[model samples]
Target: MVTQTPAWVLNDQQGIESLQLADNPVSTPKDDEVLVKVHAASLNYRDIVIAKGEPQLPFFTPGVTPCSDGSGTVTAVGSKVKSFKAGDRVCTHLVSGLSSSSAPTFTDINSGLGQHLDGTLRKHAIFHESALVPMPPSLSFLEACTLTCSGLTAWNALFGLDGLVPGEGTTVLVQGTGGVSIAALQFAIAAGSTVIATTSTEAKAERLRSLGAHHVINYRTSRDWGDVAKSLTHGRGVDIVVDVGGLSTLPQSFKAVRTNGLIAVTGLLGHAEDQAAVPTILECLINACTARGILLGTRDQFHAMNRFIEDKGIKPVVDEEVFDFLEAKEAYRYLEQQKHFSKVCIQLE
Candidate 1:
């Protein structure tokens, strides 16, 4: 399905204040496409970069809608759309969806959803059947929307690469309470891995513990939080460290992950640090561990993650305040401000 939708156009790529929304039109699906009645859309750091015309990405289509992560119901399907049907629950994936074993290339991301193509931020959107995944049953549309990006990135970090899926006796280190970190914490716990999370406040630390983190370290107080995480593991170090803070936090993350362990570089939050300086290979070599940069996941991995979520009854954590469709700019701004605990979303009825 397709339509001339007056969606949330990223006008001029100036900033969040430029997001424009309209109900637009909903058309029937094409032979290989599926029409979706988008129920919800979530924001990611990449979305903000595109909306604000940040240099993180080399190309930005200014007129396109600015979000790739969404959850919706299939309203119609083309004759050739076999994987999805009318009334089925679904979510959007990067447009050029990858194979199960395929690693994403820079070109793939360059031509992906919310990048080269129009995104899934509208009330009604038509996507190629291959670019949609069945939503995890245990999650509502709001929660499912998050799985498109941050959730999938976390899943890929924990289980996707090198066949290192965290299980019993695995110790995971998560930094902050952002979407990726929180998702990693939840998925690790579900897989029976002990998790150690770092946050700024005791209040947030308590919330982390409530979410099943075995140890919560206040990074503000414990300046050497990497050593703290290592001590928590009795000097063996965590098996996996999901590092959201890039330049500022990588040193500690290096200290946290054990030798030959994995450090998933999912996000770079706070300030303009992510835009400028990044962790160097020298640091990784000195730390004696691999630091892998994650860029979401493939369609097959998305399905696998969804199955695990449904089987474990995992529900993504969304911010308490959800926005209406008209508040698209507000949602982007909220996520830009980094005030939310996990995901910030707009709900469309």
Candidate 2:
């Protein structure tokens, strides 16, 4: 007997309104794959950009599902599957076929789940056993769903081979209170680093401080917040800067980082016009700082991050407004508004 699953597809020809629910036939897992009953999925800014058919993110095919982050229970495993069983709870990795070499590009076949292949925004999805990790027992499905993209991106920025790898007494600057930034804040704190967080409002700044931020900067009130961040560290500047704002904020990150510091360029939330500016590259060279572009991490990094989260008892800060699976479009709209403090999750069951 065949099985059917409900999913949302992005059709470039139809625009945002065309993203409607459709029923898809669930394929049997190949010898190295596993079938998952996806229970929860999370939203990211990239989803909104993709839904709007942005020219830069041309990875979506007409009928492809749209999200990379999800958590579920394993319903079946193929003959060759060794790590997971039918009853195990699991979360997916954003990219597959990643090893220590990391030689394959993002365009490689099966490299990115939501981009290069079908994603996890469905009731049931099949993935290679190697691309899935056991969910941390301390988290719910909604929270676990967030790990695949935003969480992993933060983890990779801080701990990957080219990452910052903060330790005791290290000072790190994180921008805003979004999922990745908040995850970075928590991870830095757990690693015994001093966190300097930036937010747009005082209320949000206070909230960030409550979440173990050693210092909070209101970027709105202080346009030259980078210099102010440097002042707070007594002119030495921070050891690492997690720059999610891309070009618009990169200038400030350049000012805030210490000489020989590491800056992880992770997102492009700033304006397009600002992105074209070339001076930021010169600034990085002038400051003698290393700026690395971070992608989602490998399976080994994902497993290690989970162990850290478990050991530290860290909880992912999910937004209060949880949407049902049928309200997937609404979830996207909410994320587009960018008002949510952390993760916006869609519950499937």
Candidate 3:
């Protein structure tokens, strides 16, 4: 008997309204590919933007499966594949396992799954061997799903700095309670850095603190969170700032970072409208700080980050809600609200 996979698909060129769950046949893996029976997939702001008419790749259409990060068991592998076999639990790297640059950050996303190629909002997905990372035994599929995109972005932002050592009293500022920032807090704190986290809601501040954030600032109430950050750092400013909250927050991030500090810019959910902040960013750079733009990360980096997580037993910060594959759209909606604390996951059979 043939199996069918139900996937949340965006079939129109306009908006999220066009997204629908459709039952499609499962695919066969190519010679260098393996089929993952995706167990849990997570949502990001990118999915929301892409669902609302932003093309994943240039000249790409609207109707593709939508989400990059997922964890699953290997159900099948092609003849040429040797690293994995049936029943192996795994997650895919953010890219298609291809390298475009040598820098720790700024790797080109050429054939991204979920954006241009088909993604893991379905029961199964076929990807290259290099895309797969072995899941740590300590993580459930739900927890493992968080690592691919959010975890990697946070890891790259904090640990990817050139001259910065892991320990030795470094301070890092993370904005918002979104997946990446939350993960950044966990990672930085674990690595012996002082973590300052910001949230719009006072209620979430406690949660952030609980997640190892040394200090929590309510961005809505505090007009100058940067000053608070500076004060926390004894007026020296933090060593790194995970500037996920784009242009609106970059100025504050500029003020928050120490001289020669690194500001790793990831998400622009807050700057979707005005992307041209280069002049202001340059001013910040001239002040003896480095601002690095980040996409997800390479497969090699993903492995290295996973190794750290495994060795440290650092679990991901997951929210209370878990949706099944059929309810992926609902999960995406909740992620957009930014009400949830950590990663939002969809469980696929």
Candidate 4:
């Protein structure tokens, strides 16, 4: 067993450039925890935010390791551990001990792996048994690591609330080719729902089609792409709109959904701008759709999503570029530039 491991730490500077690779002590797991030999860790938008020390996160522990989503093999288990043994493959849940059905509170958010607590950027990490779920059978460590955040959030958006399961004859509209949107597209198609995706370029549009999207809308060329999306659905509008662009795109999302349809507000990727002439809330009222915010998901949702991915042979889309563990800062910059197709990952070994 190794006594030390290489890990990336976000020093007091708080930015991609601030990440430092250091040799850190690796301790044995505690009575209720297991030590894992991490194989890969993946990036999410939130990881970047935390690395920069966002002021809103009052409880963020500075100089802590960063990254929430990871996949690893259990190397050792404490005496009290029972559900897992050495050599079992697992993926992390963002929060350390989340098992509740409700959305996370501020306290829960403070305990997130990459924020208030030490995260999985290290080559080895110790986690409570409840913080992990069995790895999906069909994916490699690189692909499985992404399920910890993006895949689970997409699942929660579509199936986590209101018992609304999208399947045959249902329609889902996903925004852009980011991690969560791409994940949602994959899950919806696997469950037999027709998907309409929006992207800026024809290149990404082709990729979306090849991934089983029924139609692709170029949001750049057509400012009113929402009307185009509705037209593709025969003026009936879509059943769900996975809205990642917050206020800048909410008006279009409202225009794209059917009456009482759902718009899952997954991210605020858009900048402040005059997107439309009307008030955003009025658009929701006019469209008669429910728009709610998403904050990743819970441990139980992570487990259920893993099972669904395994059962359907769905592998979350990972970017072609794989970074070495030492290149974590570069990975963060690449993701910040918004060039990757979906998830960006770094290998530990």
Candidate 5:
């Protein structure tokens, strides 16, 4: 029988302000469930949005266990569980529902472990064995923790949608230095594409360049960033634009991509504060570009991406600031500032 444990719960609808830590019983595995002793976890912008509360909480765990991606050790498994045993180091996929052994259909509300059910902010969690993947031996717990969300999302954009090929010399334009952007930049560079990364400040521009960006654009200085992007491409524009800032940066992004280029919409960054406009769509069509909405990728894609990162020794770009599990709220605040170049993580003991 699984014992009780303590977990952090979102106290109320004031968003991050509502997070409250409390003790709750740890659930035992029913059939294929595995009990995980979570060691590390990372936050995403989606977690922040849910913490703030919404009427339609599409797919996430409720209350205070807010983060989606985490890594841990398997301590116990249900009678029917296979593929994992005690002492296995593992990370879970974003859509826990898809991990169901019966091949989940559309009805599972808690398809994602952390979103609709309690997530890894707690010391222990009960997840289906299908939700788990062995942690890459090459990656530390923190680095592996990023895979389930941003890492997978980046993987989907490059390989799934764009069909990125190594040594292709195609140009990949990544927006800003957030988790997805940095992940995309890393993958693009590894795939032998020329990377053009945009940042709001000179400091971040320097960092982006240091991380293998072939060129860095300070969108702050170059107000007409699309023209600059086009100029940098020698007026050809880029082949792929990792469009993270959906509506706000949409117009500029449209102008930067090449004819037949692939634009993967990965995030909003407050750009989707309002709905996207028709002109943006019109312009993209005029350029003959392909636009796709990217979500966290599939399990097959996750393994593929992991193999790539592991083989290449590509470490995730992480923030210098580290937070203990108790300081989860402060970590969210830091993420909100948009100052972090990569992922903001909370370390659990």
Candidate 6:
């Protein structure tokens, strides 16, 4: 008899409304694969973009599972899978086939999990053993799931090439209180760096301060929050800026960062119209700043970040609204509304 598990499948034509819960046969792992029984999964802005049929994303046939972040326990491991075994808690890495080289290029067509292949929105999924990382003991499955995407991107942004060596004197500017931003805030604080966080409301500003942000900017009230961010740094400017807002916020990132500071572009929250208005090359050149685009990250980096999280007792800020497996669509809807302070997750026990 074949084992089957329930999964949420995306129909390209109907969009999110077409995300139907159905049973899928559990496949036996290949020699290098591991079968994970998914316990929790989290939403990202990129998932919504893919559901809306973004042209730049890889084309998926209708019924593809759509989410890149998930955590689970291993149910079975292939004969060659020595790193993990049945009953070990683990999380899937977003990228699968990237070489473990120090200078690995992430621009390859197969760099994404949900984009190029079936993702983790299913009850049971098979992944190469190399793509699985042990979950940090400090995190629950829900919190661990949040790390696969948002957490890893934040890790790569702050620690990747041209990244910040966060310490007492180092300062970081996080664009908003979303998953990536909040993760960056926590990581930077743990590294002993002062953080300047941006938010749209006073309530959120206080929440950010409570999370160890030294200064919080209510960008809505202060339209020139960039200059204000610089001011908060005693006119020296922040050492690093996690620019999740894309084109709409890049100009300000340029203004807020000191000469030779690093700006890591990791999201596209800006409008399409603003794409054409991104700051000119002269602005970046004048600041002597370095801007680099970040994908999720390599499996090695994911493991390293997990170790850091475990060592620091870092907890991902999952929103209070928890959805069941059947309520996956509602989870997507909630993420679309963008009302949550941090990560939005679906529990699939």
Quote each prediction's TM-score. Answer: 0.93, 0.94, 0.92, 0.95, 0.91, 0.94
lDDT comparing candidate 1 with the true structure: 0.84
Per-residue error (Å), model 5, residue 337: 2.1
Superposed model 1: Cα runs more than 4 Å off: 1-6, 270-279
Question: Candidates' lDDT values, in order?
Answer: 0.84, 0.84, 0.79, 0.85, 0.79, 0.84
For model 4, the superposed segments whose C-alpha errors exceed 4 Å read 55-59, 100-102, 275-282
How should the candidates be ordered by TM-score, best one leading? Answer: 4, 6, 2, 1, 3, 5
lDDT string for model 2 (1-349, tens) is 2399998877663445757788989988888899999999998877776777676675567788878899999999999989899999999876665663353344653336765567888899988876789999999998899898889889888987544588897899999989999999999999999999999988888889889999998888998899999998999999989989886888889899999999998888886345455345677789998898877777777888999999999998888899998898888888878878889999998
After superposing candidate 5, which stretches have Cα over 4 Å from the reference?
Answer: 54-64, 99-111, 162-167, 272-280
Query: Lowest lDDT 10-mer window, candidate 1?
Result: 270-279
lDDT (Cα) of model 2: 0.84
Number of backbone collisions per candidate: 2, 0, 0, 0, 13, 0
lDDT of 3 by residue, 28-139 (tens): 8888899888889988777777776564333334567878889999989989988899999998776665652333333234356677777778887778887778987889
Give the per-residue lDDT digits (tens) of candidate 5, residues 1-349.
5587767787565777778888878877878889999988888887777776664454344464667789999999999987789899999776664643232233442346556667788888888776788888888888888887889888788888535443467898888888899999999898889998888888888888889998988888887797798889899988888888877777778889899888888886744434645246667669898887776766777778888988888998778887899999899899987767789888886
Model 4 steric clash pairs: none
> Listing every candidate in turn, what is its Cα RMSD in Å to the true structure after a full C-alpha superposition?
2.4, 2.1, 2.6, 1.7, 2.8, 1.9
Q: What is the Cα-based TM-score of model 3?
A: 0.92
For model 3, the run of ten residues with the poorest summed lDDT: 100-109
TM-score of 2: 0.94
- Candidate 3: deviation at residue 44, Å? 0.6
Residues 1-349, model 6: lDDT tens digits? 1389888888773457868888988888989999999999999887887787775454665677888899999989988888898899998777665564333344442355666667889989988876678999878999999998899889999998743567688999998889999999999999999999999989898889989999988888898899999999889999999999887788889889998898889887885445565787777788998888887777778878999998999999998899998998899899888888899999999
